[model samples]
Target: MSDELPDSIHLVLVERLPNHIAVVTLNRPEVRNAINPAITSELGHVVQALNADDVWVIVLTGAGDKAFCAGADLTTVGSGQLDDLWTDDAGFAGFVFAKRTKPWIAAVNGAALAGGLEMALACDMIVADERSTFGLPEVRVGLVAIAGGAFRLPRVIPPAIAFEMIATGQSIGAQRAFSLGLVNSVAPAGDSVTIALELATRIAGNAPIPVRESLAIARRTSDLTESELVRMSDEAWSRLSKTEDFAEGPRAFLEKRSPIWLGR
Candidate 1:
């Protein structure tokens, strides 16, 4: 990891970790880390840079302990600045619809509502603090969660529960989210980012190529038939088997030592 800002990033804090993990914090605690055009644009740049860099895992969180994100900045929306809220390539928050290939872990420190929840739904896994809350209250304002929340939520959790959350505009606690499999884990209040970093460290220790390929297959085959998914998996495995890390795994096992992954 280098000591420089990936790009001239301001709205989002980008920290490259020693273990090939990047911690990206939405830096708008003044507004509960609300999503604005500046944050979205900078985040999109950061994500694009990280994707091309050596970073293998990404941990996304908000700046302060108050809230991971209160959702889109209502002030901007109310002012009819909706057009600036989303980017051409990256959708809302520069994440919801981005072509992210690396594994992303959402560290929900506090309330993640509306677009905030949608951003979390876009991630590969979510780690929430005990005090954190998740919701899609867009319907309360006569709006819909068109930021991938309506579609992804149902696929991740039960349809009934998803519908209930969307229809009623009610938020669920972290523990409840964990129970419904929406969150991978629930840490103590204010410790969501730490737990997420630990999880990212574990994932960063693996062979990057295989880990990325596996994540790609899992994400891409979600709506495919069993046979189609199998075919995709077979193709992924065929590509993975040729990597140097693939041979190193067994060789290291035979040598009775931890494998040294070159990520080739």
Candidate 2:
């Protein structure tokens, strides 16, 4: 039965790069990197594995230049295996809701619509090719972007713009997305991953604990009240204070030298 499993099980590739960065590529480019059951399960497993590994940052992208992901492979989702399109931990693509501590960067090379956009939204940052486009076009096909797009987009960008995209099934260009603060940077064609790697390197150079702490707190800024945020920040500071990196940060500054992070 294991051998009989669909090749989609291996359709996700993981590459550990320098500077403690891991690249997870969706390999089903022939179908525009659509997520099937195997992809969902495999990606979830990969994300979990990376979370426990020494990886400081993770980059997600698709195999081809045509798409980051087209969302669920309806061919499979429409079958009796709808449940298979999800994992117990992450709802879709094994990523949109997965628990993770490390920063994730979405390298969007082309179209990132529907579930594709949801996956990108889950990332801490986005690096998109200038030629790429983004949208939650599920409405075009009688579906709703329930995989996080319907809500996450509005939080990331203007609510009116996000609502229009959702209701009309339209996509915005990369420049517009950048101006709307949806993308951190726009890269040249096929350079989304390269740009992402550069950003990851910069992040990796920082103290891992503080970086993670800062990102976690920043992400909660929208959901938490001001008082709650202050308390959370204080709590995070207390936890970070115990890490070796925390002490090294100040000591290194005093010594005018770079600090080596222990990631504790």
Highest lDDT: give the candidate number.
1
- In model 2, the clashing pairs are none
Candidate 1 lDDT over residue span 1-264, tens digit each: 232346336789888879888899999998999998889878877877788888899999999988899889999999998778898777897788999879999999999999999999999999999999999999999888989999999998999999999999999999999999999999998899899999999998888998998898789767788898889889989998888888998999999999998888
Candidate 2 lDDT over residue span 167-236, tens digit each: 9999999999999999999999989999999999999999898898899899898889999999999999
Off by over 4 Å in 2: 1-9
TM-score of 2: 0.94
Q: Root-mean-square deviation of each candidate, in angstroms?
A: 2.4, 3.3
For candidate 1, the 10 contiguous residues with the lowest summed lDDT are: 1-10
> Given candidate 2, what's the lDDT at residue 80?
64
The TM-scores, one per candidate, come to 0.95, 0.94
Quantify all predictions' global Cα lDDT against the true fold.
0.89, 0.89
Alpha-carbon shift of residue 190 in model 1 (angstroms)? 1.3
Off by over 4 Å in 1: 1-8
Q: After superposition, how far is residue 8 of candidate 2 from its true place, in Å?
A: 13
